[model samples]
Target: MDLNDLHGIGAGWWSRILAGFHRDAGLEPTLLELGLILAVALAVSVPRASWRYFGLFVTMVHELGHAFAALTTGRLVKGIHLRFDQSGAMMSRGSGRAGAAWTGFWGYPVPAVVGCILVLAAFSGWSSLALSVSALLLLATLLFIRNAQGAVIAVGLALASSLLVWFAPAALLGHLTLALGIGLLVGSVRDWLNLLGVHTRRRHQLANSDAHILARRTGVPSALWLAGFAAVITACWVHAGMAVAAVAGFPA
Candidate 1:
């Protein structure tokens, strides 16, 4: 079959399957979404071994967010851990509510912005240079940011997407972007659900373990910080002129 025919079949199958699951378990739709994301991730990652480096870049971004939060609030970074398998930073400053909120909010966007730039460049026919530049930025960001979860995800996503564009056919880029967008939407929903008190064992564990650390350092409640981060992220989408309603899963 032709590419267009294949795409139509794939999309139709996915849509029907997702719709059925969405009507059944409600939670099953999320699993479907996750599966789609994993498919896309693998599609982009399986061509080469260098793609694993993207994971390291992601770890850096995640840790960098933590480090930035510490420094912005006048806290000192005691040490940085940039392990090939894991990445994070240690800081000595007490976290204030505003500082932590802003740090968390900005962490993901920074790397996402970089990714978008590289994607744009590659699409504009600057593939070689863009790939090289993006790789460098990813490595540098990973090295610099001490504790940035969002940054790590962003970098990893970018790296995977970049590699796909480099080695894969141009036809796949649109599909990859769609997959990434869906993944982000799922993530946004997951975050919102956590904020809404839907308790899972993992959620409870995270709350029990990290809650005190956050509370002791940043006098702000976690809910409020999450709200602030959501607000900032929403505002960013608004400024980008995309339909904020779509992002929020509301009618535009």
Candidate 2:
């Protein structure tokens, strides 16, 4: 079936799913949207090939989080590397202890924060704004994508987001924002869970994990960093859920 026909089939269900996301004229996600967000997150978390490909978007956001944190903390970011395997990394140089620590700490939590914000925007009827911000972030990250695979992915996403921000219809844009948010949430949760596994075992490839870097820089244990990362992600989940519920006219 064509795009329109596909959209038509799910239109009724999408309407119900997003029923309470909008109220009045403001742009905060309501209870219905929040529930939808979690539901979508869970769906994307399933181990399927389609979901796995979508996970690439999540990995990009996760790596860009590190890149942005590095730049924000006065570090010079050399480049970002996204691999075919869906693992990614940010290369940067910073001598400041705080900068190093902050960059490393941000890697795990940033995706959830970004996703939550986008979900809020989507419910707020700010699809244009949501897409614009996302587009800008991806474009800015393009300057730092060093590897060929990363460059192609970054450029492709940047172009797609830009086009959507400028041309997509309101309803389609909203769905896209929701999808992005859901993917990010799923990816963040999955990544943290993987780290938790490594933490429990007390062994992981140090070079491949953020917690190890944080531990090395801050003289803290990797397990502690992993715990803190988990806590931050949990906080994001709670915040998004409560905000959605409160706005949906549910009693907070």
Task: Assess each prediction's global lDDT (C-alpha) against the native.
Answer: 0.44, 0.74
Which parts of model 2 are misplaced by more than 4 Å? 1-42, 201-204
Please, what are the lDDT tens digits per residue for candidate 2 over residues 1-252?
999998985574334334323432444455566567567666775567755666677788888888888889889889999976778988899788988888888888888888777667666776556676666678788888889998878888877766665556655666667667766776788878877766566464556778887887789988898888888888887876675666677787
Q: Model 1: runs farther than 4 Å from truth? A: 1-64, 67-101, 104-134, 141-162, 170-175, 191-214, 233-252
Residues 190-244, candidate 1: write the lDDT tens digits. Answer: 3344434522335554443232345445776665545554564454434422322
Predicted structure 2, TM vs. truth: 0.79
Error of 2 at 99 (Å): 1.2
| Each candidate structure's count of clashing pairs | 14, 4
**Residue-level lDDT for 231 in candidate 2:** 85
